[model samples]
Target: MSYTKTQTNPTPFPLVKVGMGHLKIATAGSVDDGKSTLIGRLLYDTKSLTTDKLKAIEEKSKQRGFDYLDFSLATDGLIAEREQGITIDVAHIYFSTPAKSFIIADSPGHVEYTRNMVTGASNAQASIILVDARNGVIEQTYRHFFINNLLRIKEVIVAVNKMDLVNFSEEKFQTIKNEINYLATKSDFEAQKITFIPISALNGDNVVEKSTKMSWYQGETLLDYLENIDTTLTNDSANARFPIQTVIRPKTAEYHDFRAYAGKIYGGDFSVGDPVLVLPSLTKSTIKNIYFFDQEFDTALSGSSVSITLTNDVNVSRGDMIVKIDEIPTIAKELEATICWMDKEPLQNAQKYYLKHGVNDVQAKITHLSTILKTDFSGVEENTTALTLNQIGDIQIKVSKPLFFDTYKKHKYNGAFILINPKTNNTVGVGFIKSPL
Candidate 1:
């Protein structure tokens, strides 16, 4: 894994705008586990819902002869889902607090829709895994926990819902906690921060507000935990990665000589006059200006969406990367990765596919199938040949050209990619780059 650099300083440029900060969260659980109800409870308790929406929910609940409001009606929007009383797609809900804004991805929990759950949790900073108190831990719990561990979500909130039905028993809570704790030791995600909260989404106890019956429990409410979490827990700031999305060249009179490359900064910050390498081609350039909308800035930190103008007019375009010359990614043509197969048809051994990494999409082929990972995250199935839908497996792929990448543990944003079936133009799998070619 290696890359070369070329240095060139062109013209002095203007400043760039600042960045925006927000937290992204996702919710998961097995069917009938109150995932949607918990989200509705959060929104309702926080006063994020409108008066009309509340009235509508009340009317629908009464018409259905329900004594209590069905909060799940707030997000289960699909016609089929509403008729079936199950979540079938991803619902992205927005809410804001004084400390930080949040984007909640409500994902489906059924085993058949595990692919949609993966899509929802892929970009989340934290996740909420709901458990039905009556059922305790079950098979679907293992599946959801496995997905969370695989995605490397920083925080896990094991929300034990429907506590009211169980009489808010301390013994039941402890039992579930012990079970999850035991399973945590068997997983590869031991470093994750796990928090447990007992709540009744139907009655709104211990979810948004503290429960009076559960006097023995003493901890911050779920809302408090979510709002007070440190921003640093979401991403990394050590290694810097920039994948170029497009080359912006203003062929005008006022800025006739300007050449800018637009992309999002991933790992660390990039300052003006910092030396960079244009990957694959190994061309070198200096950062002259960083632009966010219409302002100027001296440096752009990780996760900032900005356009950077270079000192030299090298052959750079979409799919190319602008990275620090000294800290380049591994350049290779073969890769070993963990893949989550999403397509209905199982993976074919000799088929060619397109790998979309960052903003670059390139042709690739599956050269070897190594092992299939169990849902418990304990170990892999050695000597496997193919992966079926919703199956996770280790595979070796050969790409048409070398890709600049890092391990998923080091840099998730740059080390992750999606596999597309070229003929159907459909995403077939979600993959994490495990190592260089």
Candidate 2:
């Protein structure tokens, strides 16, 4: 595997504002599959590496008696990782091309580290699953794809790394692509879009620049494909939901009547004239004004933190929600959710835990351990007694009070919750509401 630096110039790609410029990408692949090298090559090819960082990598590579630079050293930060030549923890690598900035979560591919993979990819907008050309699709490939499916990640790139080892054969690439396509059909998620790219990450072919060796792949380079992604389209929502984080009241005597609900809007935009209903109490209100610090706006877009005043000073507090009347979510005390268990202790039926759903915390008890979903896209494992570490399953939970929520498929922002052990205060699991019960 070899590439000349002149194939393309590396330039700093400015991370875009809020929702436009930054891309969060998670990566998973088996050991020796070149995940770290791909990340390092991206940094190096894009001129994102500092002189000192490059020097450190170069010195490490040489000390190990390697003639060629070991790009993997760039991301394997931990001493254990350096010694083992494998990624154990999720190492976040940031870089940019001239078009867009990127944040890559280099998650481990080992089965035992599945929890880390879930944690790393839970909030990612995109993912990359690396496969060694010589080995084709392996067990870790299936696990990585399953994680993407479970998280409902919309866009995925199947990067066939180390293509040089397979002599850059077009037939080999197609074989792997067909396997992945077949696997996608088995996923419970129906609309996970996937793109295939054959590349030698170490050689930098078909990554920043198209590969000349395989003239067969007439597609955008990896970087070009990433740059062209419109995140807004992939992450669009229409149901306006505003979960109030706090009530803002200036005690200063000059403005004694100023009252506002402070929170970040999700799902859709909200204008001053939009009619909304406060949850739990079902209090009716109209948006009077929107304020960000001191500046004011007639409308507030999703992903913005702002304070909004309502025409009515109706009783509203933290944990209450302001939502468009037409798009009101299910108000329920019991929930049916798909949970990914993260704690070392198995999740037992009827266990009491504290569940925190976006800005709202409540006491919860497991009503049932329905079934464990297999990670290979196979059907569920029935009659499961308990959910063990790194296992995913469906469960019923009863909260202390009625809450406003949506299905994970409908509104990811308001549908997710975390289970914390009351004794240790450690997060035990992450749950996505499948539906209100």
Write down the lDDT of every candidate, Cα atoms only: 0.83, 0.87
For model 1, what is the error of residue 244's alpha carbon versus the real structure, in angstroms, after optimal superposition?
1.2
**Ten-residue stretch with the least lDDT total in model 2:** 1-10
Best by lDDT: 2
TM-score of each: 0.93, 0.95
TM-score of 1: 0.93
Distance (Å) between predicted and true CA of 5, model 1?
59
What residue runs in model 1 are displaced by over 4 Å at the alpha carbon? 1-21
lDDT of 1 at 370: 74
* Candidate 1 residue lDDT tens string, 204-244: 88876777889978976787788777767666555788888
**Per-residue lDDT tens digits of candidate 2, residues 155-272?**
8999999999999999999999999999988876776789999999988898876789989999877888887877776674758889989999998898788999999999899999
Off by over 4 Å in 2: 1-10, 13-19
Model 1: clashing residue pairs?
Answer: 6-284, 10-311, 15-296, 16-295, 16-296, 16-297, 17-295
